[model samples]
Target: MRVVRPVLGAPSWVSLIAGDLDVAQRFYGELLGWDFEHGPERLGPYVSVLADGVPVAGISGVAISAGTGVGWTPFFGVKDAHEAARRGVDRGGTIGVGPVSIDAGRIVIARDPDGASFGLWQGRAAGVGDPPRQTGVPDWIELRTADAFKAALFYGEVLDWDAAERCEVFYEHERVVLRVDGRSVAALRGLDRPASEDAPVETPRWQISFAAPDVDRAAARAVELGGRVVRRPMDTPYGRTTELADVEGGLFSLITPKARPSATAGE
Candidate 1:
């Protein structure tokens, strides 16, 4: 029998720090059908969220003194956590946590030059588990930053990710593109100054995007399911998108492609 190596180089893993783990678990569980698995070691009061028997995300207990706000921390796959941390620090980033072992992986938390925090995971068991495929679970990660070009260069140099193509949408002021070896792994969006100033700077904190087959239906269902619709569904050249906040107040988005207008039917 051949041992199956875990899937690698996909960007879909993220973490959330919750004031109450039970409440956070309940919200995501009801919303995404995630199963909470508490490790016996109990790495500093955090539990892991698993999907399809694989760890996909985590919920950590919040620290009042640490002044860490509750939000999602996206993790990128890396060959070596220590080396990544060194490069991040050299480029004006700061390490918030260790190249330390937690569960089946070694991860280091670091902030970008602009003070957005993200994680670098060196997998010992499997690489950030498997990609999500169902509704409610995260399917895509988007980084809305001040400088999309700088972010692209920073991540490309650090993680070896390549930009597949670049395009601009009417809704966005700057260019947006999908980055991956070939498949659509993630997106980079340029940020406006006012938005960036009001956003959290310590961590690469941003709204998570959930894959929805139908954008309008998902937005409607989110409201009916106790989530609040922060932004109405709108069509963009890239895709249709809507924003919602979970019952626990965690914000996320749902995206789908726009349909062809009747004016373009003949074309």
Candidate 2:
């Protein structure tokens, strides 16, 4: 599969770290119609996920033994790993891993002040790139946290997003949208309060979404593969979307794009 490089300060890649690498691979491959390739030796027991002959994501067993939670973590592109990590630390984010060398690049995993986990990569990435919309690839990312503006400020400084020449950050509705080259790649939104007394508190984290052809059918197949539905499919302005957890409890969402109405017959 061919690889594409993401623009600096944009989302570069995403990874699922699990102790049960085989099961994780099996679950996602079946759920998302993905293929796998042996990943870089430096990543240790890793597999690169391919969608329609293009590398889109990865799975690794490197940090599971260290008690890292099993979840889909997003990595943002950076010009300098060390500088990004330093800025993140200065802005109240905590680094969990290193600016260590990995095959073609350097990476550092860290959590924002709100405890939302993310990564920084300063090299060629074989995942999300400019105009990131693609089949079976992670298509959208959202940060659910207590404060949207604060989260925006932290990421903006750490990722050097202050320059309008590269990207633009703006508020829309109740969320902050991060746009690169005219495309909105991610959004930071405040966590909604539980609607009733018995609802569970939403956790602060980056959520990944994949485009699926059939929302209901795909969700059903996920269940047959041992995954659980966190939220039943529901209609939204974007599309029909559902939240789900892999067998190992990694969270992600599936969204079927809202169909554009066909041009009026013989208009």
Alpha-carbon lDDT, every model: 0.61, 0.79
Model 1 residue 114 CA deviation in Å: 1.5
Task: Give one digit per residue, the lDDT tens place, for model 2 in 211-264.
Answer: 887879889999999999988999865567899999988899998865422222
Report clash pairs, candidate 1. Answer: 116-204, 117-203, 117-204
Candidate 1: tens digits of C-alpha lDDT, residues 135-230:
555556677777767876676656644421221122233544443322343566765344467774422445567656787877776677777887
Q: Measured by TM-score, how close is model 2 to the native structure?
A: 0.89
Q: Which stretches of candidate 2 lie over 4 Å from their true place?
A: 1-3, 124-134, 258-267
- The per-residue C-alpha lDDT of model 2 at residue 76 equals 86
In model 2, state the lDDT of residue 157.
93
